[model samples]
Target chain A: MATAVVARPVSRTQTRSREEEVLVWPDLVFIEFIAAMLFTITLFLLSFLVNAPLLDQANADVTPNPSKAPWYLLNLQELLLHMNAAMAGVIIPTIWLVIMGAFPYFDREQHGQGVWFGTEKAVRLTIVSAVVGFVGTWFLILWDSGKIAFFLHGWFGLSGGDSLRFLENVRSVQTQLPWPEWSRNITYSPVNIVIIGEDFQHLDFPAWLVEQGIPTMAMVGMSAMLIFSLWRVGWVVTRRDALIVLFSAFVAAYGVLTLTGTAFRGQGQELVFPWELKVSEGIPGQE
Target chain B: MTQMQPSAGAAARRIEHARQAEARKLSRRSFLRVSVFAGLTLSVGAMAAGFLGFFNLRKPTGFGGVITVVPARVPKAGEEPSRISEGKFWLSNLAGAQGDVAGVGGTGGILALYWKCPHLGCTVPWNPAFNGAAVNFPGIVGWFRCPCHGSTYSRAGIRVYGPAPRPMDTMAVSVNSDKSLNVNTGVITSGGPDNPLRAKPYSG
Candidate 1:
């Protein structure tokens, strides 16, 4: 976790003497009294300036466009866009929680306990992972939304974005798949599977491939890729370093997802600029 | 003589006697602390139970009750779907839908699909015209397309694409002797797996 970088309290207790010892009655109590008075005054002024507004009455019909989860859950909501709802909404979060719970057991090195960063390389790793995680997640979201395709097509007149129609404009716009000819032929060819756009929806194999196979493989593959790259770079030699990278990445991803879900997502959960966001009140004409 | 086991009354009296003996040791501060904690626990426990019972999925009544539709309103196997906004369902027949979608329900029957998108409960509308260019689905004219998460479903309510967990939910439809359907919105079953089960045929 990134520790709050507020002012560190002076460790006067380390060199304590009876001469410096203060009584709890007037000395400590007076300071506390002043603090309490200051807080009370600040709160009074704040409340006077800011008014709490009541929201619209909850309605069952006509879903509010861009219906968002609470801020804490926006990450999961954003994840729900990229893959299967079960994997995105349920299984992934559950698995993540379990792994985090078991993280202490995996990293038993006694050096890091009770400290914000225990290892010598921790500060460097945190910054690197944070940047990589935040940027990588933002990039992936854009790529999935086909904004990258839109840009490539706009800039270079590149014409491979049509291959992304696998989901029929379901989760993304037309993706410019500038992949080689062999991959294209293999991809769009009538497969006995669900991931191949329209032809395979009737079959069971394709459904599993789309809903289960791809998500699981993508998660595993990405993590493996990260670890492998880190190992090769000599950045992650120990399990502790690897875990720190993973944790830092996770935190960074969580933050980026929250930001994306909050700001970047426009109507219909489409990726758009923050200014483009319009809350469709589901009022017939206005919508 | 062996000691006789205490009777219910005797046991209660003995517990009362023990309580009184223990009560003698309780100072006012400890007594107040114990009583306050006990009161808080009781209120919190009652509230938790109240919340569970309040939100429990009982029969969806009022707007979500059984909706009966005459035979004429039910769409043909490949026609435009009839929407019941009040009932939150689309009445469509999937028997003769083009493409591989005809595989559902064999000869097909009248399917009462709950309009709520299985992904996040946005009402899905049926596309009136087939647009081959609008994605990969060959014939999407009579398909249910969700605008919320872009989850599209075949006429049979199977998840064609998007992040929908499964097929759109189906309300139980009972065909009557006169060819009318009594669709119970209260009883909802998942589309189940990738391929949705066939609905009961209204007529040949």
Candidate 2:
């Protein structure tokens, strides 16, 4: 008996030679070098066209009316206008960074790798998130600035004095929550409540708490509501899609806040038209 | 059958060796590529970080350090505050009674007042219009006026009018052996009802 060897058949597609092959040296490196050169040229042109203005030397005694943080940190500074400084400056940023870092773990899919707006669903989610963030932040800023609040107050015929009296009375109460006399009495201490507490203290802690709490609650509640809507609408089928929506929202909100802080805030951190801003007496570098 | 089993076992061992050799070669190539990329990234990152760090380096002479404002001879008793641009402050020569209230030393005390307004930190300038000759201030001469807000300070750096919560802040002043005024910008004393005058008498 004679032994015979068998061979597997090759398909025409497999046999065809590749027309293009990507190599890192010239393909990727050249593009990178060109991009870097263009960026440098742009920066050089900007330096010549725009002169960086130096304000009068730092004077500790005379702080500018609307003291502002650096440009990158303006988002937090803008948040400071609506909420507690610790929450805006520390808590929010820390949470954002941690979430961003953990995004990769949540989005473990190999599908749609290295593609912008990877899927049609992703693009829609991003657009929806961005719109939600932009409109929400814009409304919050206007509301916190007393622009909308005062308008509605007048429109509703609510007397400013009555509103202030109500707030004062609520603040004077010993407990964190105004209702139930027993809760107030239980928490009350003669030395701490009357002296060290917000009752007689120079700084109005109760007023600050109420002022800061409303905006904080609104921000958190709205974000939670958005996520819940996405889940209920079935737009967020996967963790990757959910992350895409959240990341886009965060980016949009950050951009809006930075723009607002840089151009909108004027004397006393009050909202003003960019053209009407009196930079001479306001924040440094604005002038 | 026993002889055929040994031959089959040897063939299997030989095939495993070839596969292990191929894997080693592939891994070696990948390791080199990864290391090279990492090195490039790290060097670029380090250079960029170094460039950015340069901007944060501060000089030893400015805001937080001591600066010599002016010589003692420039400011005369009951005269206007001599503005020193370099030190960003005003040097005033007050009478002994005013100095006593200001907490300064010397026959006629010397006080260094920060040019910044106590209200909102705007630069305050001595307005000659509000001097004794002017009727607006009523017997006040060489009063400091803030351009931002209408906070007015008397010659002694005391807040006399407007929304200023307290008097103008003072810096520690020392007289050198050469009689030049050395203003310690580092030590800032807040002006309030309890300590309205925070003047450090020039010690020669």
Candidate 3:
């Protein structure tokens, strides 16, 4: 059993004073309420100022040369412009979120005590990582554009100069049929994907089945397996929470995908269908 | 005597230790409050700087609003000039006008064309300036090319290549009775095969 002990003064005994402390809750509430209202009003004004630009109407028949996505998505669209779609669209966003969520877990530190950088080595590393991520992505995009232009001309035989000529020739000349007919069967076209089974498409599908499908399934399976590991992590450092991190990551990823499609892909532009091309040209020899 | 002295010393040490622990707890609390405020300030500052840098990138340059072109005297039937580059402004003749000049019941003869790439707002410079080497592009020459991004347009300003999403816009032209070309500021928008500005032989 523990006994209560009173402390005696080192010198002569001195009398102590007692005071009552009162918290001003009303004042705190008023300040908080004001702040929240001001924030809402500011955001409303800001949203009103940011008017979005609309492109010309979407037509399936007339494809615009070098069709571009909206400005907000220029970076991602630039990625799509240079790299493969799947890599730019899905894999990059997933990687970004995974790294961000796993950060504090990987960097456990007792040192950073009260400083914002918290004498914690992990906190400092996070700041550094964020800077690196931003600068690295910007530099990577700049380098990609210049390097990509070469491939456009050298390998693809598609120069910004030559593509116009190619389209005109392809449009006018008929060697049994137009180039679109020939390209229609080549099978990267979405028309084939919805119409025919995966096996029926002309491209290498067995490889897509093994490489893409299997890995995607494995990734989902691995996430399920990690639940126990994640639970254990959350159990420690009672202050550590997982729901906010996981949910935030999911929302970020979903936002990126939605923004990518909305900002980059034109809604009504269909690459398939030749009938739409029959608009209003003159009959040859009539003039 | 020895046991009494040791007990007395232990009591003194415990009192000192308790006082120090209380002091440490208070300091840690103060430090935490300051740190949170500082971290928030830094994060906000960084985000603001990032957005500012992204928004201020360089804008593109464009040419004068209007460009005009003139075809030769009387072109033979079915004969189109491969290139039209000489005087006031660079223009590529898109299509020949039908009918006779002075004869009644004639639809009037005036070359129909315009000179601007509807995409990216860049001037579609006529490439006829390039000699036969650049011409006869695979036995057939294209009309205009964009120096900025290599967008090519036919004599009709139809976007054939590069990043332009639509055909070139047409300058409104009024051929005076004297046969001199007068171009208006208005540009006729052309797109697809049905675009009213499309030239003959190319319209679907």
Model 2 residue A90 lDDT? Answer: 85
**lDDT tens string, model 3, A30-107?**
899999999999989988998545332332212233244555554454434223245545786578578678857765
Give the alpha-carbon lDDT of every model. Answer: 0.69, 0.63, 0.40
Query: What value does the lDDT take at residue B181 in candidate 1?
Result: 82
Candidate 3 CAPRI category: incorrect
Stretches of candidate 2 above 4 Å error? Answer: A1-56, A153-216, A282-287, B1-204
Quote the positional error of residue A197 for candidate 2 in Å: 14
Q: Chain A: TM-score in each candidate?
A: 0.65, 0.62, 0.29
| Candidate with more favorable, higher lDDT: 1 or 3 | 1
Q: What is the Cα-based TM-score of model 1?
A: 0.54
Segments in model 3 whose C-alpha atoms lie over 4 Å from true places? A1-287, B1-90, B94-115, B129-137, B193-204
Model 2: per-residue Cα lDDT over A5-111, one tens digit each: 77778656545456565555877789899999999999999999996674444444445555677778888777755554456668878987997899888888998
Docking class of 2: incorrect
